[model samples]
Target: MLDEIVASRDAAGAALTAEVDAVIEAANAMSDRFRAGGRLLAFGRGEAAADAAHVAVEFTHPVIVGKRALPALCLGGEPALLGMWGRPQDIAVGICPATGDLAAARSLGLLTVALTANEEFPEADHVLCARSADPLVAREIHITVYHLLWELVHVFQEAE
Candidate 1:
């Protein structure tokens, strides 16, 4: 069982490395918005909704050193609320659902990040494709990805 977890981690790491560049770019964009006094809004459906909230909590209340608190919130799987709350400077992260309409409004200018499976592609400024087939593995990878995002966004935040 331990080996399984280790192997999954190894695979996830490799996959992440392959997409690191795109991740960096998106993080920088997110940081720019944050620096401009924008907020982090995370949304997803079903189980992913909970994950979105978790990500929001981590950002709003950092557990790490040198990472100041940032404005963040979870939409609790509700995309419609975004219509009212989302701004051109905010960043929206959709965990596992279609966000095609999330940024359809041309002037919304919301930096959108969509993490999903290959078959579930959607319109997003950044699309992070998950590499795991098992739900457990996928969840683990998702956690790792968001953790990295939180960390890197701070790095870019410091730059600005």
Candidate 2:
């Protein structure tokens, strides 16, 4: 059982590794958006909604001292709320989004990012897929990816 778990994670990690360049590129774009006064608005349904809240807190209240507390909000999977608050410079991150949310965000000119496994969100400007079939494994990979994004965004911001 443990071996299966380890192998699954290894495979997922390898898949993400192959996309490291894309991740870095996305992070750089995120940094640029932040520099332009953009905020991150994350939304998801059910369990993913909790993850979205965590993502918001991570950005708005960093665990590391001296890390910039960027503006981030959890939309509780409410695309209507996004319509109310989204701006052209804002970022819309959909963690396993329902149909049309990412589309709506893109229609409003927000940079769309999708964190998902298996499900395809074509509207997202950046799609960070977990490469795992298991829901738990996918969730773990999403957490790692978001953390990397948070760290890399700061790295790029500081470089400026």
Index of the highest-lDDT prediction: 2
Residue 81 error, candidate 1, Å: 1.4
* Model 2 residue 145 lDDT score: 88
The lDDT per prediction is 0.81, 0.88
Off by over 4 Å in 1: 1-9, 99-101, 104-107, 119-122
Instruction: Spell out the clash pairs found in candidate 1.
Output: none
Query: Tens-digit lDDT track for model 1 on 1-160?
Result: 9998788778876887898887888888889989898998888878999999999999999998878999998899887677788888898888886545466422487888877755355468787776877777777777877888899999988876
Given candidate 2, what's the lDDT at residue 60? 97
Q: Residue 29 lDDT in model 1?
A: 85
Task: Give residue 92's error in model 2 in angstroms.
Answer: 0.4
91-146: candidate 2 lDDT, tens digit per residue: 99888777677887799899888888854667889989998998898999889889
